[model samples]
Target: MKLSDAAVKKAKPEAKPYKLADGDGMYIEVMPSGSKYWRLKYRYAGKEKRLALGVYPEVSLKDARERRDAARKLIANGTDPGEAKQAQKREGKIAAANTFEAVAREWVENRSNDWTAGHKALTLRTLEQDAFPSIGRRPIAEISSSEVLATVRAIEKRGALEIAGRVLQRCSAVFRYAIATDRCKNNPAFKMSEALKSPTRSHYNTIEKGGFPKLLRDIDGYQGSPMTTYILQLMALTFTRTGELVNAEWKEIDLDRAEWLIPAERMKMRRPHLVPLSVQAVAVFREAAKLSGDRVHVFPNRNDPSQPASNAIILRALGRMGYTGKMTGHGFRSAASTMLNENKSKWGIHRDTIELQLAHVEKNASRAAYNFAEYLDERRTMMQQWADHLDKLKAGAEVVKLRA
Candidate 1:
C-alpha cells in the first residue's frame, strides 16, 4: 500500500528494523531506535540497488514518493539513478571550487612571473576592492555578460571611470583564462569596452620655450632650502620623471663616472636607465651630498630624514616663483623635449638619441632589451651641451644657436 502521512506518523518502532512498503520499490525504513529513513530500491543491469532519498519527517511522505517517481523515470531511460545522484554531487563540488575569484587568483598566480611585485600587488588589490565583493563567489561558467556589466557599472557610478575600465579589462583576462582552461565556454566580459564611460584627457602644465630663460633665472635666484634649490637645479638638468628623481638613492649616482644608473625596478618602463650627468649636474649633486651624504635618499625629507622628499616640494617652490598653474614638476620633461627637438639641427643630435635619453619605451621589443645603453656617446655630448645652454640662459646671456 502507498504510505499516508497519518499511517507513517503513527507507525512505531518494533523489536528491530522494519520496512513500511509504499510500493514501486519505495519504502520507509523504521529502526528500533525510533529513527525513520526514506529509501528507494531499484534494479539496474539485472542487479538490485538502494538510494537514500532523505530522513523521514524532513523528506515527508509526498516528497519521498516524488523522489521515487523521479528515480524510476531515470531507470526507465536506461540510466542508473544511484550513479546519476553521485555524478550530481561531484558536479556540485567542482562548481563550488571554480568560482570567479578562485579562477581569477589562479590566473594571476600563473602570470605573476612576468609582472613586478608592485604590479602584482596593485592588480590583486584592485580585484579585491572592486570586483570581488559582487560576483566573486558565483561560478565562472554561470556568470552572464549582464552580471559582469553590472559589476563594472558600480565602479563607474563612483566617478572612477579609469578604474572602472581597468577592472573590466582584468575581468576579461580572467574570463579568457577560464575559457582556455575549460572552466567556461565564453568570456562574459568580451566586447563590453564600449559600455564604459570614457575618461577625460588632460596634459601637464608647462612653460613655452620663450619663457624658459626667465623661469631658469627665477629658480636660480629663489631663496628656498639648499636641498630644494639643488633638487630644482638637478631636475632642470636631468629632466627625469618626478618620482624617479625624488626617490633616487646615493648609491645610484657615480660622481666619478658622471652617471646616474636608475635601476629597472624604479623606472616606469621596468628597464634600467642611464643618465649621463653633465658637469653642472655633478656640481648640484655635490652640494646636495653635503646635506644628505650620510642618508639613504639623496633628497631625504626634511621632516623625516628616512623617507624621500615629497614631489610637492618642487611644485611649492615653483608656486613661490609665481608659476603656480603655468608649470609643474613634470613640466621639466616637456620643456626639455620641446627645446631639444626644436633645436635638433643646432644641437647636432639625432631625434632618436633625444628620445632614448628621455627614457621612452622602444617599439621594437628585441632592440629594447639591449638598447638602454644605445647612443650613449651621443647622449653624453648632448647632455653637456644642454647644461651649458641652461647656464647661458640663467646668466641672461644671448641664446646662441649651436653649429651642427
Candidate 2:
C-alpha cells in the first residue's frame, strides 16, 4: 500500500519494529524507539538484499520513492544496488583522503631530496598561504582548471604577480604528481599560464667596465665595518651568489688548497661548487679569518654570532658607498661575466672554464655531479689572472690587452 506523509507521522511505534510500505520495494521502518528510516528491499541474483536509503522525515515519502526507483533501475541492469552503494561510500572515503593539499604536500615531501631547505620551505609556504585556503580540501582529481586559475588570480589581485606565477607553477607540479601517482587523471593547472598577469621584469643594476676602477677604489676607501669591506672585496673577486657568500662556513674553505667547496645543499643548482681561490681572494679570506676565525660563519652576523651575516649587508654597504640603485652585490657577477667573455681571447681563457667557475653548467643531475670539477686547472689559472687583473684596475693602472 502507498503510504501518506500524515499516516507515516501518525502511525505509532508498536512493541517492536513495524514498517509502512510505499510500494516498489520502498518502506519506512518505524522502530519501537520511534526512530524512522527509509529502506529499499529488492531481489538481486534471486537473493533479496536491503539498502538504507536514508533516515526519515529527512528522506520523506517523496525522496524515498525516488531512491527506490533509482535502486530498482540499477537492479534491472543486473547490478546490485547494495553493492553499488558500498562502492560509492568507498570512493567518497578515497576522495577525502586524496585532497589537493594532501597531494600537494605529498609531492613536496617526495621531492625534498632535490630541493634546498629554503626552496622547499618557500614552496610549501606559498601554497599554504595562497593556494590552500580555497581548494585545499577538494579532491585532486576533481579540481578543475578554472579552480586553479581562480586560486592564482587571487594571489595576483594582491599585487604579487611574480608570486602568483610561482604558485601556479607549483600547483601545476602538484597536479602532475597526482597524475603520476594515479590520484588524478589530468592536470587541470596545465596550459593556464596565459591567463596570469605578467610581472614586471627588472635587471640587477650593474656598472660598465669603464666604471669598475672607481668602484673598486670606493670600496677600498669605504669607512665601515671591516667585515663589510672584506665582503665587498670578496664579492668582486669570487663573484658568487650573495647567499653563497654570506653563508660561507670556515670548514668549507681551505687556506692551503686555495679552494672554497660549497656543498650541494647550499648551492642554488643543488650541486656542489668549487671556487678556485686566487691569491687575492685567499688574502681577503685571511683578513676575514682574523675577525671571525673562531666563529662558524666566515661572515657571522655582528649581533648574532651563531648565524651568518644578513644578505642585505652588501647592498647596504654599496648604498653607503654612493652606489644606490647603481650597483648591487650581484652586479659583481654581471661585471665579471661581461669582462671575461669580452677578454676571453686576449686572456687565453676558455669560455667553458669561465662558465664552470661561474657555476653555470648544465643542470642534469648526473652531469652536475662531475661537472663541478671539470676544467679545474684552467679555472684555477683563470681565477688567478682575473684577480690579478682586478688588482691592476684597483691600483689605477692603465688597462692593457693580455697576450694569449
Candidate 3:
C-alpha cells in the first residue's frame, strides 16, 4: 500500500516495531524508541537482500522513493546497488586523503633529507604563506591550472613578481610528485608560468676592462674606516660574495694553511667551498685580525662586536669613493672572471680550476660530488697569480691585448 506524508508523520510507535510500505521495496520502519529509518528490500541472483536508504525525516518520503526506484533499476540490470554505494564511499575517502596540501607536505617530508635546512624552511614557508590558503584542501587530481594560476596571481598582486615565479615552481614540483605517485593524471601547474608576469632582470653594475686599474687606485686612496679599507682589499683578492666575506669567523680561516674553509650553511649553494688565500689576502686578513682582536666575526660591526658588519657597508664604501653605479662589491667577481678567462692562455690556468675558485656549482651532479676538491693544488697557484695580477693592475701596468 502507498503511504502518505501525514500517515507516516501521525503514525504512533507501539511496544513492538512496525513498518508502513510506500511501494516496491521502500518502507519506513517505526521503532518503540520513536525512531524512523528508511529501508529497501529487493531480490537479485535468486537471493533477497536489504539496504539502508537513510533515516527520516532526513531521507524524507520523496527521496526514499527515488532511491528505491534507482536501486530497482540496478537490480533489473543485474548489478548490486549496495556494492556500488560502498565503492563510492571508498572513493570519497581516497580523494579526501589525497588533497593538494596533504600530497605536497608528504612530498616535502620525503625529500627533506636531500635539502639543506634553510632550503627546507624556505620551501615550506612559501607554500604555507602563498599557495595553501586557497586550494590546499582540494583533491590534487581535481585541481585545475586556472586555480593554480589564480593563486600565483595573488602573489603578483602584491608586486612580488620573482616570489610569484618561485611559488609557481614549488607548486609545479608538488604536482609532478603527485603524478609520479598516481595521485594525479597530469601536472596542471606545468607551463602555467607563461601566465605569470615576468620580472625585469637587472645586472649588477661593474667596472669596464680598462677601468679596473683606476677603480683599484680609488679604493686604495679612499679615506674610510680602517676596517672598511682592509675589507676592500680582501674583497678584490678573494672575489667572494659580500655576505660570505663579511660574516667570516676567525675559526673558519687557517692563516698557516692559507685557506678559508667556508662552511656549507653560509654558502649560497649549500656546500662547503674552499677559498685558497693568496699572500696578499693573508696580509689583509692579518690586519683584520689585529683590528678585530678576539671577536667572533672577522669583520665585526664597530658598534656591536657580536654581529658581523652590515653588507650595505661595502656598497656605501664604493659610493663614497665616487664609484656609485659604476661598480659594486660583487663586481669584483665579474672583473676577476673576465680577466682570468681572457688570459687563460698566458696564465696557463684551466677554466675548471678558475670556476671552482669562484664557488660556482657544476651542472653535472655526479662530477660535482666527486670533484669538489679536484684541483685544490691548481687553485692555490691560480689564486696567488690572481692576487699578483691585481697588484700589477693597481700599479698601473699596461693592459695586455687579447689575440684575435
Query: Which candidate leads in TM-score?
Result: 2
Clashing residue pairs, candidate 2? Answer: none
lDDT value for model 1: 0.89
Query: Each candidate: what lDDT?
Result: 0.89, 0.89, 0.87
- Model 2 per-residue lDDT tens digits across residues 79-180: 999999999999988887799998899898898887777878989999999999999999988899999989998888899998899999999999989989
Writing each residue's lDDT as its tens digit, candidate 3 over 1-404 gives 79988988897899999988888978899999889999998877778888899888888888888998898899888899988889989998898879999998998887775565657878999999999998899999999989999999999999999899999999999999998999999998889888889997434688787888888887778798989988888899999988889999999999989999988777776778889899888988998889886999999997888999999999999999888998898898988988899888898999998888888878887666834567999988888888888888888775442211
After TM-score superposition, the amount by which residue 243's alpha carbon in candidate 2 deviates from its true location, in angstroms, is 2.5
Q: Positional deviation of 365 in candidate 3, in angstroms?
A: 3.1
How far in Å is the alpha carbon of 217 misplaced in model 3? 3.1
Per candidate, the number of residue pairs that clash is 0, 0, 0
351 Cα displacement, candidate 2 (Å): 3.6
Best of the two (1, 3) by lDDT: 1
Residue 18 CA displacement from its true place in model 1, Å: 17
